[model samples]
Target: MSSKFLFAALGLGFMLASCGNQKSEYDRFYEQDYKDSVSEAVANAPEPAPGTRTPSAPAQQQPAQEVHPGSKLIAGSDCTACHSNQQKLVGPAYVEVAAKYEENDKNREYLIGKILEGGAGVWGQVPMPPHPNLNKDDAGKMVDYILSLNN
Candidate 1:
């Protein structure tokens, strides 16, 4: 082949090779089966009988209370980046955290500390980065807001 034709072919080959490695959005979404598994587990797990109370429903259905003002600061500052009330993002959903820490004051403090100083292995292998910008009071307020998600 002529020199110009050979270079053009090589460049086209390189472009095609790069494009082959790129995942489609659907592929990317499907690759994380863990998310689907977690969601399924939450959905399929047996629920309390009609008369019995369940933790998940009560927390969401309860009337709103005076939410901590500082909680919004924390949420806006960083928490909402990965967490939401209904779905998993980077971290477990807020309801999951609320269920775990509900009725336990000490767990609240521990989690607040975790927020200030990031740690891994608690929720999963994923390490939650420390938020040095968050002071104790603000962190506490965020924790309280998280707990309130149950209500």
Candidate 2:
């Protein structure tokens, strides 16, 4: 009887542990997207004219970082596992991609397709894994962010 009780307790404990307070993947992605959107808004906000500042406002406001929506998507997804903005890892650096391809409609479409279909021979032998689950709109956003790095 005691052995049976112990086993039951262990199973209960395992179930409780599995259900512990942890953010779901969607929750994490949503939070990151919200944060990035706010940052982008702040970054794009026009500064007040020199004489228009209220006395109560701080003398100097640091420039807000311009975060792209795609950056959040990339962060939330598995892209960062192999790629980075500044340096190459398992894949080419995002900056390199930007440098290679000028931002244009044709390039954008091509890149979006590449993201969905995956490819190799362009960035060396290691093939880029396809993201069948990611939609074209999201892929285009990611490409925009990567291409923006050129500037």
Candidate 3:
């Protein structure tokens, strides 16, 4: 009986030890496989045509996106999490907003107020959360950025 118990205990200990080492061995195998696949893909990739930019080309060779002061302010805030310039997410796209309203002082002021105070129903049922932290001038900048998308 004692021998049987000892054998069972040793078997369990060995099983647990093997299980622990198995994960690390599996991880090493997976990492090697991933590296091999990436290397193969790079090797198989076609070379860039003459006059075209290569993958290793400097960023300065690429055309830069124009940035506005209002865009800079919006990028620093939580606006991007919900809104995009072209595609709609939680709210309408900036372009959509711009399209709906004409560029003018009254509309600009109204949008600034909406940004600061928050509102719903104009676009849909989802209410735009208020931005109490942002001042009127900053909100106006954001509004300007959105409206500029029309042009």
Quote each prediction's TM-score: 0.53, 0.57, 0.60
Evaluate all candidate structures by whole-model CA lDDT and list the values in order.
Answer: 0.68, 0.76, 0.76
The 10-residue segment of model 3 with minimum total lDDT is 53-62
Q: Provide the lDDT at 86 for model 1.
A: 66
Per-residue lDDT for 1-151 in model 2, tens only? 2344444455445445545568788756655655555556555656655334355533232233655788778867988778877768889999999999999999999999999999999989999999999999999899998998898
lDDT per residue, candidate 3, 1-151, as tens digits? 2344444455445444555464676766655555555556555656554334344543432244666779889878988778877778788999999999999999998999999999999989999999999999999999998998898
lDDT per residue for candidate 1 within 9-114, as digits (tens), equals: 5544544454556677765554444445444555565645433334464465334464367455654686766766666778888789888786477887898899
Error of 2 at 61 (Å): 18
Task: Assess candidate 2 and give its TM-score to the true structure.
Answer: 0.57
Candidate 3, lDDT over the whole model: 0.76
Of the candidates shown, which would achieve the greatest TM-score relative to the real structure? Answer: 3
For TM-score, candidate 1 versus 2, the one ahead is 2
Tell how far residue 97 is off in model 1, in angstroms.
Answer: 0.1
Off by over 4 Å in 2: 1-65
In order of TM-score, best first, we have: 3, 2, 1
Error of 1 at 49 (Å): 35
In model 2, pairs of residues that clash are none
